[model samples]
Target: MTRSPATPLPPPKARRRLRESAALTQPQLATRVGVTPATVRAWESGRTTPRGRKREAYAKLLKTLAEEEAARLAKQEQEREREREQEALPEPKPEPKSKSEPVALTPAQAFDALYAFSAPALVRQTFLLTGRREQARESVERAFQTAWERWPEVARDRDPVGWVRATAYEYALSPWQRFRPRHRHPEPPPADPGDRTLLNTLLRLPPRHRRTLVLYDGVGLDLPETAAETEASTPATANRLLHAREAVAGRLPALADPRVLHRRLAELASNERLRAAEPPAVRGGGERRARFRTRAAIAFTVALVGTTALTARTAPTHYEPPVSPGQAVRGVPHKVAPGSLSDEELELRQKLRDQMQDGPERLSPRLE
Candidate 1:
């Protein structure tokens, strides 16, 4: 075949790219290609073209650089394709003889784990709310019970611990709970007189203030978190906390420091020796309670409906006049004087005696 024309040099940008790909400066490239650095710059800037031996050498170098770039890109693409294939490969089946693998936890298992983790601390915290270990235990159990009842909502909550904590706190601090005779009388106070005094002071604070102080000073929550949990403004929470601290400090001057107060609160709570019920027990109780309430509601509704129907069916449609209240006498008796007889009645009686001499035909002496 006849000799074909050589390919023209790449554009300015491509020429620069090829040079940079080979990791060579313009001066180095010019030295290798037998040209001045100025000539290489002019070539890369598209201001001039090379010719003869220099042109041929420059073209050869650029072709090598292009081949190297193409090879590098191809290698990278190959590596990416291999990675994709590996990812798409199916996992191998376990052999029968292989040791059994660990199984992931079920929802119940996870819930139990969470309950075990949170319930003890919750009981202690609730004890501080009520100053009664029984109430605290019940509150924690009931809170967990509620959590189990509405577990789906609780599981998806941003903070499940906080959800249960709030529930327990609400239950423990309920105004109605304080009226119940069972919870009204709390267990004995701490053995230490000072400790007993501190706890009494804590219990005597307003419910909101106590809750705020317990969450902030006792539970180590920051002011914002305490406010959020207590459903109050930050300033309100701060104020309550301040008042609670002042009350406690008034009772015991040594607990004036917040850190010292925190420790004292913790110690007071720990000293209560509160214990929580088992998770399964709480869950079962919740289910039973829910069933009982549901049945009661259904029965009440049915009875109400039945009563309404019966009333509608048996009701009188028209007005009924009531019977006359007064009764009438059937007959009147003749009047009789108490001690005197009438003269006319006496004359008529004497006349009848004179005229009464008539006799019957069969037996009388005179007959007419």
Candidate 2:
């Protein structure tokens, strides 16, 4: 018997392939198809399949997606072929190295590379901290601009990303921005309601808790790094993270799982990166230096005044007579001798005369 023509792939296999080819997650696909994620998962798992009009619609969507995927692959292949053809052409001779070419990257070059590499993640991390995209962008831009101005110091730092992150966090947390007028309408919300709720809940937490959570979870920093960034001890940072998790779980039960929390944070960070703007150009280093010097001077003055006040308050005070050594030795009574001698003085004089008589040779010079 002749084998029947190969049947089409089952619904589960077809759905899975289409979803993968389209580069869509189950949740993303579900959102586009106006169905729950669990339903999409079930369809992909072969546990269930769409029925009637739902089935027809699902099949049509998958067909369209498959067509789009084929078109994209074709375009990609064409680009690769062009690249291969270019490679086939004879290459131009490279210019000889110049003696003036620096052997190492300059501070500016290093800072520019770092800024380009880190700005997106830094901005995303700041967005997690501040919960405002505009503020996060501004903060990261300012921080990197600072890094550009102080490239030498930042390049020498063990944790340059951490430095930029800390600066961004500081800028995002500034109170002055609260008084500024906010946009009447905000950007469209994230696709995930859970994520939006999680962010809202996080923002309601105490600043320390929020910062610890973002540094640890959102930025993927280790406990010690997070502690250092937040200026908290390790144990304290750990405790804050625990409390922050509990607080978030109270509002968003799904976030109670560590894995889920981590996944969500990764998603949020990635989304923010996609939405972030290019960092602004480095500004006047001189003005920044001047501001830094002014701050240092003020801090030094405050510290000096505080130290002097404390010393004065705690120091011992003692008073001594302003008399000469001779006067002090003679005693005050000798300095104020009476006009008439007392009985004791008379007795002392008689005793002195008797002693002089007994030693007449000693007394001869005075007597003569």
Candidate 3:
């Protein structure tokens, strides 16, 4: 047997939805429709039907609102169904662990690792800063020696490379190096004209600007890290970097790019053999000597103080004026006799008299 088609729902229920969707209250809807709100409510409740123009407008509004609501519901249902399908499927397996895990290093091993990794870069950076290969090598070596000497503290530091960089930078800038005869020798010009020009240009910058540029771009440190290494505030570091970039751009337009600078520095560092160089010897003597000097100073100071106190107490007291009012009034220079002589003159006269009395017996012959 054939089934009958389902009847469509009445527009009265849709009238309320249409008004709601239109964001209009019954009073507002009534104002729009030019009818009382009670009449609008009656029409929505299916107790009455709008007639003529009102009927036509109400039916059109209801049709449009009903279609929009149907589309929205369909979209919501589709999303829910998709979520259900996704929930029904099996979850993916977690990735497998790698076969080899990183091994933890001891302090010495860690220091060795850092020395191997950072020496070449540090040497290259120092070379750029100082424009002297020997000075650069010495600075880097001295910095590493210091690191090795205090490996435990260095290893515990957040950025050991930064620490070494700061140390090497300071070492490269040492004023005493100017006085050393070896450092007095003029550096041979760089082989590459480009390198020479770049080095000269970099050297021309104020030391702080040069240091900021190198630490930020050359060493690839972040602004805060760069600031910390350079001992400047972040804002000051940023300003220095800006001025440094401007200066470099004015001189070498091509090398101003950070990537190009990094590449050029890498090329400069490539041929330098870092791995073959031995780990810097950790000398405990400096610390021992420092401690010894401190103890010696303390002992010397105590001995000096004790000696001063003993002398103050045991030594003869000189004649001092009394503090009494009468003595203060009486304290004055006494008049001396016109023929009076100093004690030294009197002593000399007495010695002459003795010599005169002794005569020829006391006289000793002087050799010609």
Q: Give the runs in model 1 whose Cα sits over 4 Å from its true position.
A: 1-104, 183-186, 318-368
Best by TM-score: 1
Q: Model 1: per-residue lDDT, tens digit, 56-94? A: 899998989999999999999999999898987897897
TM-score for model 1?
Answer: 0.60
lDDT of 3 by residue, 236-334 (tens): 889999998888889889877888877776665454443325553423433455578899999999999999999999987887787865433367766
How displaced is residue 221 in candidate 1, in Å? 1.2
- Candidate 1 vs 3: which has more TM-score: 1
lDDT of 2 at 212: 91
Count clashes in each candidate, considering only residues at least 3 apart in sequence or on different chains: 0, 0, 0
Question: What pairs collide in candidate 3?
Answer: none
For each candidate in the order shown, give its overall lDDT on alpha carbons.
Answer: 0.84, 0.76, 0.75
Worst 10 residues of 2 by lDDT: 273-282
**What are the clashing pairs of model 2?**
none
How well does model 2 score by local distance difference test? 0.76
Highest lDDT model number: 1
